[model samples]
Target: MSTKHFLRGMATVNYFADNVVAARDWYSELFGVEAYFQMPSRDNPAYIEFRVGDDADEFGIIDRKYAPEGMQKAPGGAILLWHVDDIETAFARLKALGATEYDPITKRGETGFVTASVVDPFGNVLGIMYNPHYVELHGA
Candidate 1:
């Protein structure tokens, strides 16, 4: 691998929500902690950020109203997959929270990777995976 200093490990994952307040509340409740940062606005905030996981990676919820021109609102392209200890529990919890199932857990026979995904209430594709290589490298 080239030693370029660009593109570090998934520093942030962003999802847009039409109802920023409701998204913030739902995510916070699911994450079991309040967001650590938010951008203020006159009406509903433009952006809210949550820092989660042992690595304290950033997960953000943005107002769909602020989406840049040409940003697709459909449930396709660029799903953010988070590394989880238990794929089954993670997938189930998201569904229990009313997230629609997109893809059930699937394992690559040789690669040792397993993944599952869901379409959230706001239409974001959230994926969870058990990546043995990630754990082996990061000791998470």
Candidate 2:
């Protein structure tokens, strides 16, 4: 018998936040995902993991204290962008989940990408993007 290991794909992207619980809840509601794991450390305080849809891959939220000091401030411009099939549907779902909508769905050139901005409960800016042409271009 032989044991093999392989890289399937990106599992998650982690963001640092001041309030782990709030961030976790915000992401859960916005992405319609649930936290699969939670670990606490003296320096980091709280670490959480959320799985997207039914996929095994997960997204992570870590306390600012655990991340590098400079990352305390949320990323500027576009902090996070999620690629969905339908922007309008995703936007409505997120809005219903208590997300504050900052912009309406708008197109992006000939690619047919639509995006909107929202702030999470912990003050992190997130974007919901729908680009059907993405997979064809990036080979995802």
Candidate 3:
């Protein structure tokens, strides 16, 4: 028998919200495109999904009421950072749009990387970063 690894990059990101409808609407407005996939019905969906970026990364929103067993409803955890051209602008935009700052933007200086994070109103930790390595490896 042969053992192999098949761990690829992130394909889906799920966000839990108290109100699925509001979360979906908020994300729709932010993304500027309606969700291409939804469960039940778009008008009253219990779960919603959106495909984003050139890679078609899966982003999802699910009602907290339906949260899986043992899932904590706290406001802290591992952050999933999205690549951005300008960290400052992205950080500012998120804050202006009501996302409270969880971690202020900080430059790594020598590494040519900067990162910032915000707690979205729906309790998800939204992160934004300017990573030169990512640009060099994947292009901006």
Which sequence of candidate numbers ranks them by TM-score, best first? 3, 1, 2
TM-score (C-alpha, index-matched) for candidate 1? 0.89
Candidate 1 vs candidate 3, lDDT winner: 1
Q: Candidate 3: misplaced stretches above 4 Å?
A: 1-5
User: What C-alpha root-mean-square deviation, in Å, does candidate 3 show against the real structure?
Assistant: 2.1
lDDT of 1 by residue, 1-140 (tens): 98877876787888999998888888987899988777895246779999987789999988898787898888888777788999999988999998999988999687879999999999999888899987997796
The candidate that achieves the highest lDDT relative to the unseen native structure: 1
Q: Identify the candidate with maximal TM-score.
A: 3
RMSD over all Cα atoms, model 2: 5.7
- Model 3 TM-score (2 dp): 0.91
Q: Candidate 1: RMSD over Cα atoms?
A: 2.2
Model 2 regions more than 4 Å off:
1-11, 41-45, 53-55, 72-78, 134-140
By lDDT, the better pick of 2 and 3 is 3
How does each model score on TM-score?
0.89, 0.69, 0.91
